[model samples]
Each structure stands twice: as structure tokens, then as C-alpha cells.
Target: MSLVKVESSEGITTITMARPEKRNALTQELCDGLYDAYRAFEAGDDQVAVLQADGPAFCVGADLMAPPAAMWKAVPHVSHALTKPVIAATQGWVIGGGICLVMTCDLMVSADTTKFMYPEAKVGVFGGLMPGIVSRMPHKVAMELLLLGEEISVKRAYDVGFVNKVVPLGEERAEARRMATVIAQSAPLVIRTLRDFANQTLPRGPAEIFVPERYKLETIANSADRKEGAAAFREKRPAQFKGR
Candidate 1:
């Protein structure tokens, strides 16, 4: 099995795919490694988390050679189900399950040479998660990508608001980290609460999800960090937060 090599620095965590030989394809072992990493970041105070590919591609798709149908089930939900921020840094061909992985991330940065397509239609499989494609762009455009299974350009992805940024073919990971650093500079608690709010808000939310937001706000309000923030503002200095 390929290893999910990881590196962390300055409150930023980078999870890399060590299976470069297969273009970093997802396997059962990769899912286990990813779940472990996700659990670690969710439990800690990491400012940002990045998913990067080490090979010629971010992820080609699931390792078709892997065993157990249950493995495929666990593979699909890895991205969207994650609570913390995840940036999918794409480098090369992104196909099949790869599209779903990118869609699940909070932010996506693909290289100019990166190619995306859903070949499931031609291969006797259906489509995968398209992630607010209907809301982010015209239904016609979404349908074109879905039903036709055509590749979308990096520039086209940005215009539709799915991709956060695009960089040179080999510089995806660095660009993602640059975006993550800006996110990490903000208050941790605020970032979490806002992320939840942003995901589940108003029309389909607030109606059912208000209590959690209330709890989150109260936790922040009662935290020592909040008090320190006020104090720091009065003293004209940066707020020192201990993630309380």
C-alpha cells in the first residue's frame, strides 16, 4: 500500500500523496491515512489544511485494483464530510472520483495544465458530486459538464466560482498554502463558526441549525481569548489567542 506522507508547519498541515507511481490514486490505505490526518487536524488548532499530490496528478481516481466494495463507499465522502478546511491542489489529470474529491474541498487550486473530466458516462458509471454547480453557474453549463462529461478549463472553473486560484502547472501546492496562510491569520473560533454558518445558512439552515451557532457564539463569548482580544484592542496590540 502507498503511504500518505504528511508534513506540518506553523499551524498549517499538508497531507501529500506518496503514491506518485500511480499518479496518487486513492486506495483503501489512502483513505485510512486521510481519515487519520483529518481527525488530527480537527482535534488540534491547525490554521489550515491542504491536500496535495506528489506525482504528475493530484489524484487519478480510486485504485480499481483495490478490494471490498465498502472501500469505495468510504472513498466518496472523504472531502465533503470533513469539518475543517481542505484545499485540493490539483496538478494533472483529474477524473472520475477525482472530480468528487476536488468538489468536496473548501477551496480548490488547479494548475494550468490540470485537466478535469468525468468519463463515467463512457465507462458505464454515473456522475459524482458537482458541488453547487447549479447554484454557482447556469443550469445549462452544469448540465454540459455533467451529462456530456466534458473537461472544463481551469479558467472556466474560476469564472464559475469553484476554483479558488490557478497557478503554473507545477506550483499548485505552494499556491494553495499561500491561500491557506491568509485564512489561518484570522481568529480560529471565528473561522470555524463562520465556516459552519457559511455552509448551512438561512433558507435551508438557520431554521434547524441555529442552536449550534448559538452555542458556538457563546463559547467564543465566554472564552478567555475573547477577553484578551478586547484587552488587546484597548492596548493597540494583536490579540494573543490560546484557542480557548
Candidate 2:
């Protein structure tokens, strides 16, 4: 079964995280599913996307035992180039890498019950990509959340500019959809240009900068020419490279 569910109508695409049983954890399967969903949304006729999960919790971060091979693959902007904007509608707990995902979105609507936390310092595990949060909100506020490992209230998130809007529980999705509708009605070229400029203006962190480089290296590492070169070296023969 697919870990992600996509619904489109009237130029608005709803990309839902469907692993509610696991609190929408970022398992390898879920990450890949999200990656595919994002790519499809980028290529489809959808004018805007609302990212929400079908569960009490938006996400609890990575699965320690079976984490995604490339968590960046599921992250907006980091995973793929998207011309259309994504609005995150979150509820319950959004922790650690989950916060990383939300921070990248163009806008966010948080439920009243939503609690955003980055407990990486307490858990002794961090992917180091979250420092980019500084670009979105106040530096001191971002540092407080990242360094303290405490939960930030939805109100505080909104006040700090991390969250664009805060609505009552179960209303976040509706609010996000309304916002998406407005965006969908706007001029497409203007929207895309604004998003493109905003992305270019943001300062990328180590993880963001590394993901593309890693892809390049991995492509060469897994190429047929690489295998042939290794085999030729071991067999004491000339390599037949097809430039693949």
C-alpha cells in the first residue's frame, strides 16, 4: 500500500501522509512515497499543494531503526525543484526532522493543539539541516528551539513567524485549503517567479548544499563505467567505458 495519498481538485492538490498507525513517521517507505508525490505534484496541473498528514500527529521525525536512506528526498525544495508553493497544515506533535520539513514550506497553518519541538539535542541525534530555520525566523528563537530541545507553542511559532497561521484543532487543513485557493487564483508566472526568488535568497545549510553533491557522487558510484573500471583493474584488462 502507498504511504502517501494524493487528492487534486480545482487546481489544489492535497498531499497527505497516510501512515497514521505510526504517527506518520518518516520511514524509508514513507520518505520515498513523499518524494514521488512531490515530484508528481510538481509535474501535474496542480497550481498549489497542501501538505497535511492523516493522524493526530503531523510527524514524529525519523524511524531510528529504519530511517530513510535519504531523508532529504522527502523534504520540499531539497528533494526537488518545485515552482508551485506548498502549505503545511500540521496538528499534534511535529518533532525533530518533522520540524525540518515544515520549516521548508512556503507557509504553515498549525492547529491549536500542535506542538513543535526539536529534541535532537536531548536525543543525541541530528541531521544538522535545521539551522536553516534561522533564515525563516528570528535567530535567537530558532536557536532556542534547536538548542533547548523544548516544545514551542503554536502561538509562539506564529509570533516568531515560523508559522503563518494558527487555527483551532481540525481546522488547520481547512484554513490551508482556503489559502491555497487564493494562491491558485493568482497569476502562475508571478507566483513561480516569487517562489524562485525567495528560494534563491534563502541561505542553504550544510545538508541542503550536500544533497545535490551527494546525488552527483552516487550517480557516478553506481554507473556501469564505475563497475567496468573496477572489474578491469582487478582482471588486468582494458576498461570498455560506454560513458554511462
Candidate 3:
């Protein structure tokens, strides 16, 4: 049976980690399945994607018994490459790679009972996905997570802007789907363009923003959807965007 199960409908693709027997630990097969699922969403017609897990824990990080090479192959960073929005609905333990997965997503809706941690230091290895945490949060917070390897409360994650929302346990997926449905109602092309632009610009320093950034913005501004948006507003009607 597949470790990852993907279901798509109404422009949203839901990918679920399906290894509840082991608390959804990251194994080689599971990694490959997840990678494929994300890539499929990027290429498919889905306007949004949701990453969720089945069982008590979102993930327990890598299955230590799995081969190192296989573990490396399962990098969850691919989710960040998606132009469409990806939401993570997490609960229980979001540890190690689980935290990495949360960090990589465009948005996160975690359970109030969720606990995030990085236990790599305890295992005598650096967290390979530490960059994900550092990129999303302040250096001090990131360092603390990395060095201490202690569980970070959901409230703390929300306070740090790491999580977009915190819901009651078991409501995470439902809430995520609601958010996805709202986002899916918007013009797909505009959503993609906005996400692409933000991803490109948000991480850059003022000195780094230059001709390339301006050029991208100009391209989006001139897109057919942009014109349609303005015309629709003037007509006082919903715009029909074709993702141009």
C-alpha cells in the first residue's frame, strides 16, 4: 500500500501521510511518495494543496532505521517550490522533518495540542532542515529550537508567525480545507502570480530587489487577468480569469 495518499477535487489536492502505525514516521517510501504528490500538484489542475497526516502525530521525523541516502531523498523542501498555495494541517508531534515540512508550507493550521520540535541534536546530527526554520523565524528563536531540541508549544509557534492558525485538535484538516476553498474561489492565475512574486521578493533584502523584481511585477501587471480584474470591478461583477 502507498504511504502517501493523494485526493483531488474542486481545485484542491489533499495529500495525507498514511503511516499511522508508526505515528507517520518518515520512511524512504513515504518520502518518495510525498515528493511525487507535491510534484503532481504543481503540474496538475489543482489551485491549492493541503498536506495532512492520518493518526495521532503529524510525523516523527525520519525513521532512524531507514538508509541515510533514502532519508536524504525525502526532503520535504520540494513543497516550497510550488507556486500554488500549500497548507499544512498538523496535530500532535510535528518533530524533525515534520517541523521542516511545516516550515516549508505556504501556510500552516496546527492543532492547539500540536507540539513542534527538532531532536536532531539529541541524535548527534545537525537538523538538515534547520534552514527552513531559520528562514521562517527570528535567528534567536530558530537557534533555540535547534540547540535545545525541545518541544515548541503551538502557542509559541503561532506567536512567532510560524503557524497561520491554531485550531482544536482534529479540526485542523477541516479548517485547512475551508481556507483552501476560499483561496480556490479566487482567480487561479492571480493567486499563482501573487504567490510567485511574494516568494521571490519576501526573502530578498532591499539591495537585492532590482530590475528583475520590477520586471516580474511589470509582467504580472500586464497580464490578461490583471486587465480582466479591473474591468470586472468596473462592471460590478465577478471577474472570470483564465489564468493568463
Candidate 4:
């Protein structure tokens, strides 16, 4: 079976990591498939996308089952890999490569039975893509995750705000689908623009993000649909946005 399987229906694309026997561990094919999936999502008309895995494990991180070159190719230039919003549904062990994937996504949802860790140090290899974790999460939390490389539960992940939801085991995919469905029902461009805004702005402190935030706010606020949205809200009606 293909390491990565992508199915699009009703304007939602689900890119699933399909290797169950190996805990869906990253392999060369899987990395290639994921990279291709990202490009496809960027080009496709699908407005919402979900990155999930099948079987007990989400991903144990990048495929150690391949040549080092293959792993590096997938690792490089994927730091800010996505321009569109991507949701990650994680379960089981989300180690080295898996942590990188979750970091790249706009949102993450894990199963209550999920496990997360970064064991690269134990293996004597460097995990460079993990910087986003430090950037997004609190300092002490990121330190705890990396220093010990211990597996963390899904509830801990959600409490730390790393994941948006934590469902029962085997329900991560369903929860992600439900979220994607809700997002798909909204305006495509508007949602995407907001995603971009949040990613670009949220990382900055109030002082740091102020200027960029103002620019984005002005850009979106000046949009015709923004006016229509405001008018609709005041009128107690649904927003009929033309995405103008």
C-alpha cells in the first residue's frame, strides 16, 4: 500500500499516513508522499485538509528505515512548509519526524492514548525541525519535552495547548474530519487568509506583532466582504460574502 494516501471528497482532502505495521513510522515513500500532498493541497481546490495516520501510531518521526539523504531531503525547506491551513491528527508515538509534521500544521488534535516525544538525542542525531515547538509552546514545556524525550499523553498535549482536542483512542481521524467539515462549510479564501494571519501574527508578542498585525487587519478589514460581514452582523443576518 502507498505510504501516504490522499482522498478528497466535498472539498476536503485527507492525507493519511497508511503504514500501520511499523506504527506508521516515516519511510522514504511516506516522506515523498507527504511532500507531494502538501504541494497538491496548495494547488488543489480543496479548502480544508487533514493530515492523519492509520493504525495505532500516528508517526514515530522521520523514517529511519531509509538512507540519510532521503530523510534530509524531506526535512530541509519544510520548516514553514505550508502556506495553507493544515490540521494534524496525531496518535500513538509522534516522535522525531512526526513532531516536525505536527509543528508545521495549523492545528493538532490527538487521541487520548496518543504519545509524543523527540528521541533524536537518544539516537545521537539532531532534530532541527523541533525549533517550532519551542517557538509555539511555553519555554519550560518545550524544555521538558526535549530534555527527557519522554512520551507525553494526549491530555497533557491539549493542556499545554499544543493540540486542540483529545478524543478517545481511534477517534482522532473522525474528530479531524468533523473539524475539516466545519471549516469547509465556511468561505475558502477568507478562512485561509485568517489562517495565514494567525500563523504570522500569533508568534509575535504584542509589541513584535503590532505592525504586521495592523497591516493584516487593514488588508482584511478593507476587503469588501469584511464590510458586508460587519453590515450583516449589525443587521442580524447571515453574511453573504462574495470574497471581494
| TM-scores vs. true structure, each candidate | 0.73, 0.90, 0.79, 0.77
All-Cα superposition RMSD per candidate: 12.6, 2.4, 12.8, 13.3
- lDDT tens digits, residue span 1-244, model 3: 9999999999899999999999888877888788788778888998999999999999988888773343433443342246788889999998887776776678899998899889898998553445546668877898899888888899998999989999999799999999999998999889889888877755632312342355357668999999999999999999999888
Candidate 4, pairs of clashing residues: 26-63, 61-97, 61-98, 62-97
Off by over 4 Å in 2: 223-244
Against the reference, the lDDT scores of all candidates come to: 0.68, 0.89, 0.80, 0.73
Clashes of each: 0, 0, 0, 4
Where's the lowest-lDDT run of ten residues in candidate 1?
202-211
3 or 4, which is superior by lDDT? Answer: 3
lDDT of 4 by residue, 41-68 (tens): 7788888789888888887776565623
Off by over 4 Å in 1: 67-81, 126-138, 202-244
Clashes of 1: 0
Q: Candidate 2: deviation at residue 61, Å?
A: 0.5
lDDT value for model 3? 0.80
Candidate 2 overall lDDT versus native: 0.89
Candidate 4 TM-score over all chains jointly: 0.77
| Best-matching candidate per TM-score | 2
Candidate 4 worst ten-residue window by lDDT: 72-81
TM-score of 2: 0.90
